[model samples]
Target: MRALQQCLTLAWRSLVQVRHNPWELGDYSIQPILFLVLFLFVFGGAVAGSTEDYLSFILPGVIVMNLVFVTVYVGHGLNSDLTKGVFDRLRALPIPRWAPLAGRILADMVKQVLCILLLLGVGFLLGFRMEAPWWGLPVMIVLLLAFALSFSWVMVLVGVMSRDPEHVQLFGFTALFPVTFVSNAFVPLETLPSWLQTLVALNPVTMLVDSCRGLLSGGPVLGPALGALVWAAIITAIFAPLSVRALNRRLMGQGGAA
Candidate 1:
């Protein structure tokens, strides 16, 4: 209970930073607008035959990609805090070791909600609609955020092991770009080569994208949604412990050799 409270306090601290420095939201602000507009206009006619059709097809996928991309911020922020000796100072506090990490992650989740809303607003203007029931839209938003939360441990592991925040961000793009773009985010998997179709079918991003597509635009739901949840479970089960161990290693004064 005490640890949860401490975590919330630190989470509030993370949110407070936005009030002081609003530019921290630049990525959340511009990236969504650019991706939504650019993709809908640039590829819509070729891919889905019309902007309206492509808007429906790509909005949920773009939201998933947006949330996935923001998870890298966890690593970047953690790496920056480490460099500033912030964790070293936090060590003196009588809080649980995981509190600070949990705090930042939770705060990031809140920021993600804002980004998703902003994108949804832009998408609405572009003719996006929720074909699913109104309740299902909020449910989809919650599930998507939970899915994104499962990615936090992976970022925490990368952040703890990286030499610096820039490296963290660099590694983030290299690893995330291929998985996200290569999947069914921007284009239909059926249109891809046979081998790429198989690979896209196996991609967790594809599962999430499909799940989001179903929930928001009305399609097959159960299979991809369950698959995405399983992927989330697998990722968190593997990385959460690894991230905790990583923090322990740092607490014991080991360098970022891992």
Candidate 2:
């Protein structure tokens, strides 16, 4: 109970900081919107059939693309706080050491929600329409939240192991851009060579974006949705505890150094 209270308090503080700095969050929310418009308006007609057809296909890609990239920020923020000894001060309290990390995750997850909503709003304006009923919207949100939690777990571990926030950002882009662009996010896998098509189809990111689109398009829901959920579970299972262990080791190592 005490730990939960501490976590909630710290989480609120982190969220308040985000509220104060709206522009930074806005950048994350807006970049994908511009990318979606630019790509669909400029190249989509020549690449895909029509602008509307491209919008339907690309909206899901854009949502997951934003999510995959923005999550790196969570890890970088964690790294920054740890490097600056912010966690040191928090550890001085009687609360569970995990509370701060948990709080950070919670706050960042909220940011993910905001980013998704903004992208969705922009998508709607750009002529994307969902074929699913009203119930599907909430379900899609839930799935995305699960995905954000899972992906952020790995990033938090990366942040814990990182010495420089800039390097984390660079590494994230280097790793993420290929995984995102290579998949069926902005294009079809069938258009690729046999080997590239196989990889794009198997890419967990491709599965996620496809699953989200499936949900919205009223396509076969159970199979792809379950696959994405399973992937999220496996990732969370592996990385969540790993992140915890990494955080503990870092904190203890700092204590020894002091």
Candidate 3:
């Protein structure tokens, strides 16, 4: 119970810091707007036969990409805190060691939600419509956020291990670029060669995007959603404990060095 309070308090602190460093929100704000505009106009007609037709097909996929990319900031933020001796001071406090990492994840997940909402608002303005009912929007948001929260532990681990924020950002973009672009995010699997089709089908991002597409635009639900849930469970299972241990070790190492 005390730990939960500490975690929430730290989460609030991170959010408060954002207000002071308002430009920290560029990943959540400016980037999504650019992606929506540039991608919608550039690849829309080529892929979907028309700009409007492509908008419906690509908006959900773009949201998934944006969510995944913005999560890279989790690692970068942690790296910054570590470098600035924030974690050193936090370690001296009476709070649990995991609290800061957990708190950061919690706070960043909220940022991811805000990014998604902003993108969706723009998407709606661009003539996107949900064929699914009202409840579907909330359900899709929950699923996407859950995935982001779970995947964030991986970012936390990277942050704890790396000293440079840019290194973490580079690693994240390098890894996520292929995952996002190689799958069904931008184009149909049928459009790709048979060899790549298998990979696209097996991609968790593809499963996630497909589930969101179905929830928003109406299609198969159970299989893709369950697949995505399983992937989330696997990621959280592996990375959460690893991140906790990594942060603890990082704290101990920093203490010893001092």
For every model in order, what is the number of clashing pairs? Answer: 0, 0, 0
Alpha-carbon local distance difference test for all models: 0.87, 0.84, 0.88
- Ranking of predictions according to TM-score: 3, 1, 2
**How does residue 257 of candidate 1 score in lDDT?**
44
Q: In model 2, which residue pairs have backbone atoms overlapping below 3 Å?
A: none
Candidate 1 Cα outliers beyond 4 Å, as residue runs: 254-258
Against the true structure, candidate 3 reaches a TM-score of: 0.96
Q: How far in Å is the alpha carbon of 3 misplaced in model 3?
A: 2.4
Model 3 Cα displacement at 188 (Å)?
Answer: 0.9
Q: Model 2 — TM-score against the truth?
A: 0.95
Q: How well is each residue in 1-258 modelled by candidate 3, as lDDT tens digits? A: 999999999999889998888998987989878888888899998998888988878898889998988888889889999999998889789998778877888999888888888989999999998899889899999999988887787787887787699889878788789978888988987999999999999888999999999999999878998998899999999988898888878777888899
Task: Name the lDDT of candidate 1.
Answer: 0.87
Per-candidate TM-scores read: 0.95, 0.95, 0.96
Q: Lowest summed lDDT over 10 consecutive residues: which window, candidate 1?
A: 249-258
Model 2: runs farther than 4 Å from truth? none
